[model samples]
Target: MISVKNVTLRRGVKVVLDQASVTFAPGEKVGLVGRNGAGKSSFFALLNGSIHEDSGEFSIPPQWRMAQVAQDMPETTQSATEFVVEGDTVLQAARAEVAAAEASDDGMAMAHAYTALYDAGEHDAPARAQALILGLGFSVAELDQPVNSFSGGWRMRLQLARALMCPSDLLLLDEPTNHLDLDALVWLEAWLKRYAGTMIVISHDREFLDAVTQVTVHVDNARLVRYGGNYSKFEDMRAEQMALQTAALAKQADKIAHLQKFIDRFKAKASKARQAQSRVKALERMEKIAPVLADAEFSFEFKEPQNVPNPMLSMLGASFGYPAPEDAVAGTPPTVIVKGINRSVLAGQRIGILGANGQGKSTLVKTVAHALTPIAGEISEGKGLNIGYFAQQELDVLDPEASPLLHMQRLAHDLPAHLRAGQGTGEQTLRTYLGTFNFGGDMVKQAVGTMSGGEKARLVLAMIVWQRPNLLLLDEPTNHLDLATREALGVALNEFEGTVMLVSHDRALLRSVCDEFWLVSKGGVEPFEGDLDDYQQFLLDEARSQREAAAASQRKR
Candidate 1:
């Protein structure tokens, strides 16, 4: 069990936790939730011993082993499997003991070290590491690839795999699903369910927390509020509590007013002055109940498109993917991720693209966004079709050195002449528009590079909405957004009048915004008949089959 009593924590001068108390039983799966700056990460740091409490007591079992994914991106030439295997600290220690014993030529020590290595399951480390890698959306062929070869997102997945490979009694995961696709997230949820340890996670993905957490801990007003159920349950209970608090506050306000009235009327007269003084004391002694402040909700709207093109775009036997490497032979053919795609996106259509990572979900979205060309066939687009694309790599579209005003100024001139018309790119006009997205005052002048990831994502959305395109193609747009912002995005997307094609791992967003889903899998694209629940089961079954095949192949050798 972990116990925190009247703990005071601070970062610089900010008191993130003041006299906060909470308790956690062993083996509980906890979900930590709060607003963006509510210190959820700081609390995690406390558990991991990165910092100490400024006052009061915090105690955890000293014998408990801990595991956490490293935040730093790993740069190494080590094979992916080797890097993950090294996360098994006990196994590594045992191997080191064996090597030392051999060097000393000690027969008894060597025998003991060999036994320890065997007991540590040294022989199974590679298999365990590979299992983790595969479950995190890596292909079997990529298992032996160098860690440096993978992209930043893929490297983060590798980091997660390494953390899972460690043996621990307490596991801490911060936004583990940020880099995962829906299929990979499903696998991770299943894996976490099977873990026999205490797990605490911080994530913006609602379905993930609901599925994995049995308890919810909220950080609010520099205090930790513990709840008895998952995130959805906490929300319901919190709402009820707020309603009751509001009524109580109203009742208290009436009493305070009545006391003040009595004191004011009698204090002037000598006969009742004594009673008035007593009433004043009473009023001063009364503990005031604070009014409930509603959580800030971030919201922005997509402007109405200048024109809605019927049959916005049609993909007739189109092949979506990338061309061969620049170093490849000139005659080499382009790589086709999804072929024979026959689909038409109509005006006001809502499409949710579904697929495992690297299975052409992004490839299809990129093609539609005009970032990639089809390897074959044709994509017939409507004459007036305009696209507002939110790429997976949003930073690519933003200039780090530029401010929000500069970004909008450039966009104003870059848009088609028809859309621009006679509109001026005045700084005040642009600032007023950016204000709708909550970028106001001095924030509009802050360098894009210095802003938080969520702020950057909001800026991207602002730029996209300004285009007023008929078709919105968003790929993983909620990666950096908090829960409130994500909810706001869902509401805004629903209110949007034009077509939407979203590719995201957030189940809540997909369920709310998408009217239909297009599954991009098996080198082809087709309509999915069922809902997200069905897709999750399908992904689980496929992963099981793959694991079995891999195991059987190894056994046969």
Candidate 2:
């Protein structure tokens, strides 16, 4: 078991954690939850010895091994496989010693090295490494790829894979699913459920936390509160606590009012004077219970345009793909991923694009946004049509050195001549736009680079709203947003009067916002008329049919 007692942590003058105490038993899976800056990461840092608390006692078993998957990666020039192997530094050193001993002919040195390596479990190192790498979704070919060649998301996965490879009695994971796709996330959920050791995971994904954790540890009001069962249970418990507090406050208020009336009526009489004085003292000494502040509830309202024309956009016989390097001419026929695809977007159409990763979802969005040229197709636009494109990595477009307000200013200045006239040109306009997206005065002045991923996503969304486009193209807009933000975006889309085309993996968001579905399969696209739930059922039935067909093929073979 691991235990913490009387822990107090402060950053400069502000206390992040005060007298927080918690315990984790063997085989316990706990989910840590709080608001964005509620010291979730700092708490993990304290446990990993990366930071020290003002006052605390943390105890763990003497023989216990610990591993942590951090948000940031260490700078290193190593391959992915080499990086995971290096996680067990002691074992690696032992193997190195064994190698050196075998090279030497001296019997005495060889015997000592063999004994040390055996004690460190050097004989089984290769098997352990292979199991861990495979479990974390790394193929043998991918294991040899250099870490520097991977993107930020892949680097995070590498860090998690390395942490899992190490033998540990206690595991600390912070937002492990931030970079994982659906398949990898499902695998991780199963792995953690079957793990024998204790785990503390900090995540904002409700479904993920519900699947893997058995308990919840909530940090609120600079204190720690433990709840039995998963996130859903904790939410119910919190609601009950609030209800009880409300009732107790009401009863106390009634008693206080009765005492006040008695004092007002009997204070003038000498016989009742003593009793009235006592009542006054009791009132003064009573501790008033403050009502709990409500959690922020987001309700988004999109600014609807007055009138939008039909046939907002259309593509005729469109073909999209990258240029073939084998062709000598630059303008030669491009290799087509999709061809003879004719589609139209009418006003008030909420279309969702679905396919496996790398099957050109992003590419299709780019083609619609005019970022990519259609090799053999004609794209037609209706009159008075305005378009807003929200790229999956739209937050990365912000200038690191610029403040949010300054970024807004740059966008305003770049508007077309027809749209730039008669608009207010002050910081107040920018501040109002920022406030609409939940970024207040001081936060609007902060550098965009300093904001968290969720904050950056909000900033991108705020900028998009400023354009007030009639048609919105969102490519995985829920990627970095939390549950509240995702829901907020969904509400906005639902209220939007214009056409919307989105690509998202969040079932809840898609179900709430979209009214139609588009399935992008092998070299073709199909339109289906139904809500998200119907589409999901169709997908499952199709998958079942394919599985049965594969089984039949195998029998014939």
Candidate 3:
């Protein structure tokens, strides 16, 4: 069992965990949740011995081995399989002993070393590592590829695989789904369920937490509050706790009233069928959890566009990718990921983009959003089209040194007055606009480089909506957002009277906001007739195929 007893922890001048106590029995699957910057990561650090408590006790069984995903980008020339297999330090050490025994030509020593290697499951390590890699969406052929050849997100998946390869008594995962697609997310949930180790995962994904965790430990008010059952059950219990307090009940009533007004306003509009349904669900959920998050500081909505346009955008056999460099050799075509996309997006249409990682979802979105020009075919936009694009990589669109107010100011200055929706492009208006997104007062002035990932994400969202764009092209906008913020984003997207094309792994947000689905795969984009559950099954089948192919190749070799 792991125990944290009246532990007080701090970083710099701020208190993170204050006299917090929590206990985890062996084989317990726990979910650790909190708002951004709530010391969730810090607590994980403490558990892993990367840091120490300022007061009291934090301890796990000394004999227990621990495993966690590495955050640093791996800079290695090692093959992906080799890298993951090395995660089992015991296996690595046993193999080293075998090598030493062989070199010395010591028969007795070699026998002992071989026994140790077998005990560590050294012979089956490759197969186990391959399963983890495949489950995380790696192709069979890519296992022997150099680790450094993969992109940042893929490398993170590799890191996750490495952690899973380790035979540990305790497993700690922080936002493991952030880099995964729906298919991989489903596979991981299943894998974690079968894990015999005590597990604690920190994730903003509600469905994921509900699926993998049997218990939830909420970090709030500078304390650790443990709740029984999964995330949904924790929510119910938390709501009940908050409702019992007279002060919280009053606040909850006010929030419910605010949400009810929005639901009533849009309930009768046929064009807003999806949005209305989503809003209704949000309202119902808010009633249960509103008091629990009475102190939540983040909220915002996309502004209404000045002019509504039908058939907002259309792509005719369009191909999306970067143009080849000027100095490129002949026969090297532009590097296209998505091609031959023929689709029409109407005003108020909410489309969710679905694909496996590296399947060109981002490329398609970037092309449609006009962040990248199509390499072939045509993309036509409605007259006076205004687009707000959120890149998957926040740093790509945000200046690290700039403040939120500054980003808003620059955007207002760059766009024409008409695009600002008649809201004058002035500092005070921008300041007020920032406030709506929870960037109030000094927070508005804080440098973007110094803020948390969630803070930066909110600022980017604020900047995007400030222009009152008629179309929103969001690529994983909820990546850095917490549960409350993700819910708020879903509500805002539902309320917006603009076209939205979203690419995200967040199932809850996608299901709530999207009326239609587009699958980007096989080097092309096409309308998907089914829903998110169908997509999950599709991923499982794909993973099974890869595993079979891997086994066949091993036999051939």
Q: Best TM-score goes to which candidate? A: 3
- For each candidate, the alpha-carbon lDDT, in order, equals 0.85, 0.71, 0.85
- TM-score for each of the candidates: 0.89, 0.75, 0.93
What would you estimate as the lDDT of candidate 3? 0.85
Worst 10 residues of 2 by lDDT: 285-294
Candidate 1 lDDT tens digits, 1-557:
99999999999999999999999999999999999999999999899999999999999999998999999999999999999999988888999999999999999999999999999998778878888888888888888899999999999999999999989999999999999999899999999999999999999998899999999999999999999998877876775675576666575565445434433443332133332233233223221211111233455677778889889999998998889999999988888889998999999777889998888998999998889988999999998898989998976668989999999999997888887765567889899989988898999999999999999999999888888888999999999999878866765675578999999999877875676789988999998877777889999998888777666655675
Those runs of model 1 whose alpha carbons end farther than 4 Å from true positions after fitting are 245-294, 421-424
Candidate 3, position 85, lDDT: 94
User: What tens-digit string does per-residue lDDT give for candidate 3 at 12-37?
Assistant: 99999999999999999999998888
**Would you list the clashing residue pairs of candidate 1?**
none
Give the number of colliding residue pairs in candidate 3: 0
Candidate 3 or 1, higher TM-score: 3
| Clash total of candidate 2 | 0
